[model samples]
Target chain A: MENSVDTLLPTLDDGIKCSAITSTDGLVLAHTGSGATLDEDFLGAMGAALFAFGSKSIANLVGGKMKDIVVEGEQGFVKVTILNDKLLMVTVAEPLKLES
Target chain B: MQQATTSISAVQIAHNIEKRRLFIEKPQSQAHVTNMKDAPIYKTRPAVLQRAQNQDRTPLLKGEPVKEVKIILAGNVGSGKSTAIRAISEIPVIGSDAKAIERNALHNKESTTVSIEYGMAYLDNSNLHIYSTPGQRRFDFMADVLCKGAHGMVVMIDNGCRDPLNEMDYYLHQHGRFLQNYPGIIAITHFDDNNTDTSLLDYSTYLLKHGLACPVVSLDARNTLEIKQVLMNLLLQIGDFKTGKKRA
Candidate 1:
């Protein structure tokens, strides 16, 4: 499980800052990258929370399951994906600069 | 490029609001309230939401534009905060109760509130908007958001938890500043009548040590009347606070 989370960092581009496998209730199962700056526990918690809120909104409003949610903020972007019924894969990446 | 970024930000904000509207829709979990003819007035009025989001509780005291009385229910996981809202709310409660995938060993409940749960009850010719915060410690931000413009707050502590008194202390300290101005009530739920290990007086003494004057009561969250009585006490506290007659 740790290897799976660790390998994801290398596969992605340099823009990727951190990644983690979190439980549906926001517990960090596996994590890698930028441990010095980013708090993995806080990241896992917020990721689970964001996914739960998105999934619930989709289930209640449109009557379907949420595949993923990408939130683009000023500094970076947070991407959350449903890995299974009970787990989620959350990735934090820097803002994608458009090629001029 | 800056213009493009700004536009995208606006779109993202709209997307978030759309989700909020869908969740808060009066009918049974419908996503779009825009088409509903009898949509809630609070949902329609953006200004009211702005004020509430800004943590403006003055309107409730003045009895002006904000027609609803906002109250926040906050506590630890599995403390029956959501159940209390469901019991007392007249409308179908808007809930985001999701599977509790973590801390299973600690808590017996399978689901936990990940986001805020909203419910409304019409009482005393006014709408009492009850917002219950997600009980998990990580979702404390949701609780703070719901605390915006709240007339009163109720901290529901589960008597059956491993350390109920410590739990009460944590929640009270978390919202201590807010409780100092607004009314705060502590209702001990899941009380086993036969279990006399912890008494109501114990809670009162605990509060006194913390220099908090919030009222403490034992309650069964599933009982609608009992929940209503707790809410009534909160209302009375609100009244007392407004008149400068709050308990010492």
Candidate 2:
């Protein structure tokens, strides 16, 4: 299962800094990163927590399961997506630097 | 983005409406402050008692062969949330405890719950699934996740802490929405560890002043009998909430 995150890494663009695949129970299965010093455990736990609550909230309010959650901050973005019922993927990426 | 905010705002509006309804319509029960130990659990509500007797107390999962009741145990680090579950659970607890990266330590404990802990106990006719959240504020998202569809909340506070009242206030505010709809109980731990001046009545009074008519009791989380008492009280409180009967 950890290979799932590694397999997806090659397909992502250059802006991606790190990525992790975590169980729904918040355990990190696999991770791959190059640009940032990522804490895989913390990332996995936070991602699972966010996805669980986000999915529930969306289901209650919008009448459907949430596919993903994208949180934008001043420094970067954290995106969490539900890969399946039992797993979720989290990615931390830098903003696209527009060549001005 | 506008649509998302609107949907969230609608939920907030509905929550506020429910709060207002309870506060205005149930003034006698909502405003009353009585000693929980002395008060009868269901003095006036026979329907709730009958329902419990029939094993129809609110189930976490509906249409299941076995009735599952979800309860969330929450508190600060070293407040004994995990220990309480261990004491009461019939099976081995599934814990996500890990070493703390931060230097700050409470109760000289090095490791803490990183995500969630789970335990299970079978009561007369119901299977109780107990879930505990990590105590750190950074892991608060786990608490929010566990709060969904929960039957009740047990907030264990360490009495020996420097500012137990402040900790109580923080937990109450953090789970205010859940408390508003479901029953909540404050279980004070570590009372013997320190001779704190704050009495149990003070906790009850604080809760009443803050518009929460929840029970406050002291117990050693490691003691199975004491933990059972707390859960029994919580079940009674859940019954009270369901029947709209306020504890007198």
Candidate 3:
């Protein structure tokens, strides 16, 4: 199922730009799409680190669990969603139509 | 042999013995000495050493003081952008609580952002003020207005959605031109759901291809330490810019 998800990722219309299945540990289980070399292992680790930081911040503030996190910049946008205990999905897209 | 023994006569033997005794008994001269007894005496002068130490350390306190950093968070809706801002803000953030408002004649109430949310936090004694603008398209003008004088920007994206990259393109379209000279950080959020092959480095490469000169960090807006690290990196970037400006 995981491998199949990985394959389907590259096929998700080019508008999707880039996609990755990262573990709670920030490990990149799979990725699709292109343009630029991405280090899956490092991103995976960093992803976990990001999750821990975000969750801890919210917890410290008594805001409860983190539902999702997003970041936008000139070049593009990055969205992080907590899918389950073991997985997170990260998506990158053009700045246009991101809110939609 | 007996005649040879006479060569070292009683007088000469007595002279040698006397010379040895004098060499052994006489104290060493003080000219080349380090004055071991005076060493402890000098140690007793703690006040002088304290003053010398203070003189050596006093110069560091005389420089330009730290300036507060202003951070502006700009992004599209559902990018978890607001949550990202809330994560690092030290003060209470004023934001909407998922309420719907009517937009037009259709009477279609939407959970739109009514007012801007602002918060502040301190990063290692340096103040950081963060603002979250409405993510709706209608608020683009407002977003641009709020983003006008920011020292840095944190661009967020949602990874679970189908067309996440469009958010990046939209940001570039609306704010990229102005931010061309600004230092920014790209944060990829929502890593727990969608399964894709793209990596953060790949996303970073895409940004660089679009002519952005900054670091791309994979971040979960809910994590505090991760957010702090990102902020730290941004602060370092600001420091670098100041240094470059001073040099120029």
Q: What DockQ, on C-alphas, does every prediction get?
A: 0.45, 0.07, 0.04
lDDT per residue (tens digit) for residues B1-248 in model 1: 00111122445444433433331222354466553222222221233223323322354455555446899999887778888899888799887766776556437687888777889975433568999988878778777778888999989987777777888878877787687667777887776532336666577667655566566766778987666656655664565556755332
TM-score of each: 0.75, 0.58, 0.49
Order of quality (TM-score): 1, 2, 3
Kindly give the stretch of ten consecutive residues in candidate 3 chain B with the minimal lDDT sum: B36-45
Shift of residue B125 alpha carbon in model 2, Å:
2.5
Candidate 2 ranges beyond 4 A from true positions: A1-13, A17-91, A94-100, B1-66, B243-248
| Candidate order, DockQ descending | 1, 2, 3
Residues B130-245, model 2: lDDT tens digits: 99998866577789888999999999998888777888888888887787678777888887775567766577667655666666777789997667666765675565566766
Docking class of 1: acceptable
Per-model chain A TM? 0.86, 0.84, 0.74
Candidate 3 chain A lowest-lDDT run of ten? A40-49
Residue-level lDDT of model 2, residues A4-73, one tens digit each, is: 4578643456787788887664667778773346577778878866775676568767987788999998
In candidate 3, stretches whose alpha carbon ends up further than 4 angstroms from where it belongs are A1-100, B1-64, B96-112, B245-248
